[model samples]
Target: MKKTGIAGFLLSVCLLLAGCTSQNVDTTPVWQQTLPQTGVQMEVSNCTLENSGPVYYAMDRVDTDYWTEKTAVQVEGVPVVTLYGVDPEEVELRFVENVSYLYIYYDKVMPQPDLDYVLTETNDGALQYRLDTVYNYEFVITTEQGTDSMMVICHRDSLESANTGTT
Candidate 1:
């Protein structure tokens, strides 16, 4: 009877300890943190940050497992994220804070210069377009082959201060 009582007491203590030891887990994504400005290639979730000289871009292999990757670059100091893979028909950009100006780039096949517009071409030959004043910026890019989506996170409060700038 004493052994049974001791066993029951031990079991109760173990149960209490187990309940007290439960850990609070964070389900938040890791990319929301302050990313390294060193431009070194690193892994975040299923994506990889790729380095090219002084610039760094995020690449995910979800578009094609074999030889293709969806790539994105945060526009320096400005609160902008440019995603590139193939020719995108539609693209949306989002930030956690209030976004003032959102830009979408639709590449024209010919190098025709329009006198009234400012065009910034990416390294992958994609033309840029500006979408003004969005409160909740959620960006999505759709191509003929597939659709790639990304979230533009501002690591700092001052990141959204300027319409255009690079860190």
Candidate 2:
């Protein structure tokens, strides 16, 4: 009888613990929506932040397995998420308290002139995820493929100030 009672107690405890287990729920803001494809896929769900998660970087393959390996550096080989239709202003709302970072992924081998609107790169004979020029809160990440790169932008004056001192 005691054996059965102990087993019952253990079973109940196990069931209770399992029920309390946490789930991996996505907490993306509702205002955040998919970006229209301009050569890039239109899925905001694919859009992620360095602070929120790890971004995969592969200089050779876009295979699911490769991305699963987990890399945080700039992509040099495959896949980039874009915020095409979403304006910087709309993005500003998401990072009000958090750091305002932007990852602009260009799916092409952009020439220096082509990026003049945002940045200017050195004439070095090699291309990589690099940025040079105006915009103190922005970063550029390039991939080796003929398409797709990511640019991370930070709007300090506007959103950085939104940080509240409270815990």
Candidate 3:
């Protein structure tokens, strides 16, 4: 009886240790854990226009605030373009083309059913989701030499400032 009890105790301990150690071993590959396409890129021109539109002002404000609070750098001159978006659960932004345009992209993880429903309803065969809930604005500055464009993307809260009616 004594021998049987000792063996059972040892077996239980071995099983417990095995269970604990198994969790520490990672079998997934490094590439599987990270996305290949992630991050932001930007380019902007140095030339400034006498008439900067609302879009330009908003972009500049966002750039200044982002850099000051996040990057800890005092950037000189205003950004012509800004892009904000997600890439596989990571948020990234890029300002590009001599600050001529801002391109934003982001990765979002929504429920598969909800995403499917949204896509089916908004697809319109264009593969672009119809943005019904967001407010968008564009400001263009035409110069003798060329044209400069500014775009503003905001949620409903910011739309009140523009005096656009929302339901």
Candidate 4:
């Protein structure tokens, strides 16, 4: 009985040592060593829901540098552009603009919640201008839930007009 007990104890020790051994080694940095130097091509999608004005665009795995450049132009001279529901440390913002529209991009460190309050409050209401133009633009939140990428669009002009009580 004593010999059997000793054998069991030895087996347990061996199992514990085996468990401690690293099974899969990953030496790569947690964040990519180098993000894409150029802007990533984004796919634009129309909002499916009715009355959700303006087309939407998105790209998964976009590099940090790309987002930075895009947001730089979008937020120029814009006061109080706040990014919420995301870890401030792990993300970067980019502002960009063309003849057509302004674009804001975010390089998120983790999947974060969408800023729904901003969306609901500003959509198709008095606050539309505040979300449309650069004068009062906002960071539209994006998130991954299950297999879908949830996005919110900011209509700067509407938001602005609503705030100032201008028709």
Candidate 5:
């Protein structure tokens, strides 16, 4: 009986040690290192959700798969970030978690000094602006409690030059 008890203790210790020895760790960078050369790109948005509705935000550089997480009944107002961009189409803001009722507004002109651009209102109440040259535009989103904003930039000049192979 003593021998059986001793064997059982040994087995339990081995199992505990095995569990301690294995762990899953994710080690990935939080941001893309190289900038896209010739495309409309927006940096990942970092903001908080307020008013219990949809708003613009992003997860950290790591674990940015916002679509994978189950929707929460109530977001805890944590600062999250998401990276999204487009080359030509008007940029769209996506609120990763709770987004049933988010609203966004775009500035009429590009934010850069001495830059002139125009924004046209779309049928869906969103604004659409096409970039003829490399430019950055600033926009804002608001929820019930507060508002957050981000910048969208397009590198169309680079793309045009690349296609022409002149620069």
Candidate 6:
């Protein structure tokens, strides 16, 4: 009986170690911000989100599989950047998470400064902009169950600090 108990303990320890090792570690940096309008948390990577800047534009609505804007739009970026998006009433509880790709389509949106990217024309004649060198990055979201994957789209301009004085 004692031998059986010892074997069981060893087996449990081995299983625990295996589980720990099997989990993948995500090194990507995620900058999160809670919208003051609705008190919702927006988790994202590849950029920074801010509330205190000239209100460039706001997140208008989200469809079944896409997040879009209401008025015209713009996305300025580099390998890293500061982004601004306001208006939480329309956004409701549509918080951004696990976004792996961000697509910005603004009417007559201006070009990106300090970044090297080209604008492409879609098959439908709408302009598609590639504002960053890294196009499709990965986002790992660890939930209570496990890690979940998601895609992303967002934009911003530089400011001093988060929710600080305006630019």
Off by over 4 Å in 2: 21-31, 38-56, 59-167
lDDT computed for candidate 2: 0.28
| Per-residue C-alpha lDDT of model 6 across residues 23-137, encoded as one tens digit per residue | 3323133544443433333333334433222222222224324553221111224323212232212221112222223222222332333243333333543222233432322
Candidate 5 wrong stretches, greater than 4 Å: 1-115, 142-144, 159-167
Who wins the TM-score comparison?
1
Q: Is candidate 3 or candidate 6 better by TM-score?
A: 6
Tens-place lDDT per residue, model 4, 18-75, is 8854233222221111112222111211111112233333342243233322221111
Query: Candidate 3: where are CA atoms >4 Å away?
Result: 1-54, 57-62, 65-117, 120-125, 136-167
Reference-based TM-score, model 6: 0.20
Residue range 37-89, candidate 1, lDDT tens digits? 32222212211222212211222223222322223333222222233343333
Q: Which residue runs does candidate 4 get wrong by more than 4 Å?
A: 1-52, 55-77, 101-167
TM-score of each: 0.28, 0.21, 0.18, 0.21, 0.25, 0.20
Which candidate would rank higher by lDDT, 1 or 6?
A: 1
Sort the predicted structures by TM-score, highest score first.
Answer: 1, 5, 2, 4, 6, 3
Model 1: residues with Cα > 4 Å off, grouped in runs: 1-76, 94-119, 127-136, 155-167
Q: What's the CA error at residue 65 for candidate 4, in Å?
A: 23
**Candidate 5, 15-49: lDDT as tens digits:** 99898545332222122221233232222212222
Clash pairs detected, candidate 5: 54-99, 58-80, 58-81, 58-82, 59-81
